[model samples]
Target: MAGIWAISCKPCELACVRQEVHARDAEAQLVRLASSDNVLSLIEADAGVLAGMLCSTSDLADDEAVSLIERVAKLVTCPLIVMCDRLDPGLIARLFYAGATEVVAGGSSSSCEPVSSKEACAKGALRQATSAGAVAHSKEPAKSASGMDAYAEPARQVHDRTAFHYASSMTTALDEPDGLDEPDELGRSDELEEPDEIDGLDEVASRKAMGGRSTSSEPGAPVICAIAGRGGVGTSSVVGLMAATAARMGLRTAVIDLDLMHGNLPALMGIDDPVDLARLLKDSDSVSETAIEATAMMVSPGLTLWGSLERPELAESMGTAVEQLIFALRDPADVIFIDTSVAWGDAVAAAVAMCDRCLVVGAPGPTQPESAARIAQLAARLGVARTKMVSVLNRCTASSLNEEFALRFEMALSLHSRVRIPDGGSEVSGLLSFGRLEDLARGESRLTSAIQTCTSSLLKELGCAVPEGFGKPSEQDSGGLRIRLPWDKAGEPR
Candidate 1:
């Protein structure tokens, strides 16, 4: 049970009951709550011992009174007690709702005849509280002052400044209630109950369930994933393959081709047209599901591709649009893949920074690993974590994975999967240009199988559905056009 605590208890009658309880419950401590003068000083001196607080009603009206209280509120994870003189009904309601565990009367008169103005003030406060619908839970009231020599100096220091005035011939009697524990003991009881209530993974799973494939808006979700590599290294192709894999497994995936200068997803994916992504983000309210649908062509169940817009001049205007589109797709997307431009630019960097993960794709070559490593280093400097990144080794065949070939290329990216494009000769480029990448998820092609295996592996890692078709990608396939590898080739540079 939580320890019962009160503040400014110098005149309090309940101290006796508190002391007895403290004596009876060897493990428990009855306590006095903290006041402004000492609470902040103590918190600053030893932050760890601090738990929570109860604000006195007088301090709420005085802005400086809660200065320490507000600061503590932001730091500590414990609950607060709200001790009031006469709480505003509205204020009381809001306080309780905002995590105040209990509210109790703080200053009140305990005697037959109230002598001091402060006593009259406290009793009036009690009446005001009663009028505001608060119950009189504390049976006894606090005692008032005797002569000028009465109070202990430390007790008087609770208020910031004091200007004392003596009443004509008033003398108030005070007897410390048997042995009430002070405020510190009360805070200790609360600290013991808090950790278990807060330290669970319920929030993460709920957010993932609501926000597509990524976990909630918390610290875990990798919002940004970049695909960066040398020119003509199949970067866009890998993005389409990854997006296709996500969609095939029932994810509402979006493939955003960010290569404004020479974006070919629209042409490469065979759309042969332009979709105004920049315009959609500029006029966000007008951009809805229908607008996004028009901007992105559906390739499979829960998957869509936003073809590149025509004027390369409009690339600068596309950044905000991409941001808006990502925000809008939060609940709908299981995976969002961005196909980066050939050269790293502000837009490409911005896209990489925005994603939860990055997939740097490269072909079997000398410079690929070095370029990928530079990209990884920059990402690391910017605070991207190792787990949030993976390298994609595209178009690798058994020949590409061989010891001699691997010796020449030192891999830098996540090489868990490799993409393959058959030598369909001249028409291969034309056919690939118009085809939606989604076909790879269902077709009887080597490329399709390679992509499916990669998707299954990713979904399993992220705790998503594991379809029966899921299989592991291997280091080699003797004659196939494509084979996945878990490690980068030897020569590309580590």
Candidate 2:
């Protein structure tokens, strides 16, 4: 509750004042706002309470008080009640100027003995408090005491959440090689948008962002990232890891698992199962940020997730998901991961166009030459620059046969930055079995090292500052490889 400072007041006076404050729910909402050495603390805060501390009058520190008032005003989300011991026109005026939403005199009409000049002071403070409350209650929606309307009530503000924090201690899972089914020659998976179908990438981007009909004013480029590959290749795992890492790095990271084929990122990351995306699509107009965001549970203070839908048909409604997905990423997250499917449909193409980075994961197979080629060619057609693209070699192995896979795949490898991932082995099993990779990232796992090196390299290329201890970790952590005793399967190959 908001404090009413006592200055040599009689016992009766304290009881009378206490009764008045306890009677009003608004007064109960505000607690004391304390500032000392430039640090302010709000105590016993009620969402709608108004609070103010006493300022001396004889010396008339109006300018100083005004500055304090303005700063404090920004903190209170509800209307303010400014209490003064004695009403002075100058003080009242200064309070308003300094951003006190309301000002009043503090006192009661009763038989309490007066303390130091308290008789006058008490009356004035009561008057100000009463006036402040009345004025605030009359205003439409009652602007918070600080008179801040926008972002004034932070706890109440809501939006769809994405999980992509640049966290320090999370694993970045690599998906298996992407698979491609041969279609007609015109089935060019490489070209997200057939050049002839749309005039340019901007045109397709415009349509995808607008969803054919967003009347709201255009917003900044909606934050998005594309995590895609074929079924069972762990597209969501990579998406989850990106989100986990981003969150740890202090960026509010979010993951929008657009994998309508099989929604597992939420479960894999140990988050809640998703609500129906098709149902959300049907009610797209009603999909307010608050409702949509509620679907995601915060993995940490910095990370959150908006999971994917379960049904195969849910992907059919992806056209609408793209539109809303943009709004979800606007939160203060460092990164946004969009886990997608292997089938390169128009929906996937639209997502690829909007992403800041496109990571394609693949394994070493003779067909990888052809599959990677199709992905790179399609990405190029979509106007994705070579610099913005990344190709990760998942579960890489060297077979005696087809010894020159890298050379043959040079055509696809030339299109973007490349990271050769090492076998995560048990780390992968841990993520799948335990639903967390914190231990794996902390261990001296080759895959973890590769992820740390590669992700930082990509970040540096993207012009973002390289994070600390990324490629450099404590020896006990990931910096140095562990030397196990001979009995501990020490020589086993990953």
Candidate 3:
């Protein structure tokens, strides 16, 4: 069971690869690479299959592509599949000559092919590699390049639909500390890699993040925080979609509105006079799971909601209470999402500080990237590791300016991975504005599918199992390329 490891600094590309890999073989374990450093580490540690997707024309040059292929090929024995965006015959030849086991050329502007075509190309490459006896030569069948087990114990015992069931069960087991036996002196955990930090914090910060609670040692849901430097970037909308989607997948999910001043989740969710998170925070000294649960408005089965204060008077005191609320929700929800306010302040910082993972939503604009960079710096100062943060390009349209903004964000924020959310047209906007999010979640629009893709990527990063029936999201034209958000030129209304 030598699994496949997909290496890419781009979130969208790696996501495409995961979809192709899973569709081709559900039992296969997919590992992601965030940087060239991770690539070096993976090459040194494990002998497994590898897949790499080149950047779009705007982000990557031909020489850089050659250099990357050469460096990776020189060090590893695994089979390699490379997908090029332009599909130039010369570039394809150069890639194969540089050590790529198979070169794929379908993402070109001329092809206008869907991601399914790219998936098929990758699948063909993998099949050729397997037929050529690539997996037979691996050092260990069950180990991946990261030294983590490629598949769980149940993976070997199931097939087809039952296979995903086993995988989901495996994810549940991994999320629970009690489900695992004690590790040896190395502080290791079974199944997954040992956690280097608690919520991306060092030893001292991990202890402080717990606020004197022992919850860090317990098995809990992953807390995800979504933030945008300013408003109209779809931060709250993204948060709602993710929460609803996770709930539909059978995970108990909770959405905490940290936007104390002007929270829109209550309105967007169509909940009239929802429970204010401030009420739960006022009794922070005696806050318990029961109290938190009592205040939560049930959006659907497995999904719970909590909104911010209706007015801004108590905004100042809600900082510490945000941390307390997150701590209490750890036991009940499989994933807790904090929809932080658009502004940077104590509340936003507290939410970022407490999250296991953070999604920075930036629309295409000079100011958005700058604000995103500032948020990244703030997170770094608060001890949140850069690896735990991902930039999400929301409301994206096709434009070179959008690409520039995304590139600036990547460079300024030092972020390796990014997910793109396409601009859903007026119809999608109408649904969001009128509190018809469930329609988008169950609908087939590009926005709906993109959110699903984003959710899958996050779940994979957290070692959770993606639910069944998640078909591949629709790909963009010109190799899945997208540029700007819908409201970048004009201020988008909430």
- Number of residue pairs clashing in candidate 1, backbone atoms closer than 3 angstroms, sequence gap of 3 or more or interchain: 35
Say which prediction, candidate 1 or candidate 3, comes out ahead on TM-score.
3
Give the runs in model 1 whose Cα sits over 4 Å from its true position: 1-226, 284-294, 398-430, 472-494
Query: Which is the leading candidate under TM-score?
Result: 3
User: Tens-digit lDDT track for model 1 on 1-494?
Assistant: 54332232333534433332332233333445445656556556665453334455543453443344345443443334445555343444334323233344443432222122222223322111110011222232232111000001111111111211111100110012311112221111232234443222221111111221212222111233546657777677666766666655555566777787787776555564566665455453334444455566655445566646666777766653554455445434445677877565554554554454556655666676777667665543222333345566665653445444443333444332333433223333545666745554456555656666766665554434455656555445335545456556774533
Q: Give me candidate 2's TM-score against the actual structure.
A: 0.50
* Model 2 CA deviation exceeding 4 Å by range: 1-203, 206-229, 282-286, 397-403, 463-466, 473-494
Q: How well does each candidate superpose onto the true structure, as a TM-score?
A: 0.47, 0.50, 0.57
Q: Rate the local accuracy (lDDT) of all candidates.
A: 0.44, 0.45, 0.55
Q: Give a tens-digit lDDT track for model 3, residues 284-354.
A: 35444444555677666666777778668888776545655665565545667889876656656656655
Q: After superposing candidate 3, which stretches have Cα over 4 Å from the reference?
A: 1-218, 282-284, 398-401, 469-471, 475-478, 481-494
- Give the deviation of candidate 2 from the true structure as CA RMSD: 21.8
The local distance difference test score of model 2 is 0.45
**Cα miss at 269, model 1 (Å)?**
2.6
Model 3: lDDT equals 0.55
RMSD, every candidate, angstroms: 24.6, 21.8, 16.0
Best by lDDT: 3
Residue 398 in candidate 1 has what lDDT? 34
